[model samples]
Target: MRQVESEEFERLLTDFEREAVHLETRDAYGTAVELPHMAKWAAGEPDDLSWLQGWCETLREHGRAGRSVRRARIVSEPLSDYQRWSHSIAHPMVDAGEDIRWVPRRLVSGVGIPGNDFYLFDDRTAVFLHYAGSGLSVGMTATEDPRAIGLCRTAFEAVWGLATPHRDYRPV
Candidate 1:
């Protein structure tokens, strides 16, 4: 196992060759970069979401390069404020070529989820995202072990199968 730096993980966003699949099991998050934006949302202030453009551009690049990016979010229903806000802002990413799907936690009750959210890169590397109880990110640990890779791939696929595409999700 390797401890992955945030920068290195960001690079993998554009470095992977075939596909990148991410599974998010959190209902709320306190990512430093996103907190202020979410605050604006909660305050009824408008945000241009310009901060998201770089990521959107990256997604577009992946599309042009024939690399695919997909994310499955397993969220609690009667959605948390963060997720409700997330649903409202997902259009740009989806439009930029990411396949984002949402599945209610209820739907995944019978599935075995990984201990943390993770990104599986090309089915070879798995980067597990660790977070604090307050929803702040702690760190990410990555592994190339086949068991870990298989676990992420399997879990993500199981949730993906039960998720609704971004456009179709109504976020109850």
Candidate 2:
């Protein structure tokens, strides 16, 4: 890979922050599959292969750069088969001593309803609506009040703290 200058990297980050989008997607296994598939494509790898290799490449790159990558907290209503499969692929970051978190439906309490499957990046700027066996759609605007994001993060922490590793995971 060509080395990116500091200014170029900063510019890239700025652009990502300014135009970042988020999605509110369906809770489906295909959504999970897409995450890794995109990763592989980004690394010029065969899209058919599991993003397992790309994920490791990312970790190594971050490690070499002394950067830290945080895992996401998935907040969903009732746990579904797709969520379970998603966890299987996403948990490796945590297992490798990188920071990854999750909150599944089975562990949540005092929650009125489940939040939509959404992606929050650039600190909740862009969210994409992911679906199974179809194209992705745009998610609604995440409220400016970071509180919603905070709440979701908090709930994820709560569930993540009590949830088992994928290796030990059983159906939700």
lDDT of 1 by residue, 1-172 (tens): 8999989998887899999999999999999999999999999999999999999999999999999999999999899999999999999999999999999999999999899999999998899999999999999999999999988888999999999999999988
Residue range 1-172, candidate 2, lDDT tens digits = 1233446443433344322222222455444447566555446576433446665665655555555544444446555555644555555555544555554544556543225443334454322233335434332333434766555445444555655544555544
- TM-score for each prediction? 0.98, 0.46
| Backbone clashes, each candidate | 0, 9
Model 1 ranges off by over 4 Å: none
Question: Judged by TM-score, which candidate is best?
Answer: 1
Predictions: Cα RMSD each = 0.6, 9.0
Candidate 2 local distance difference test against the native: 0.46
Give every collision pair in model 1: none
Q: Candidate 2: lDDT of 5? A: 43
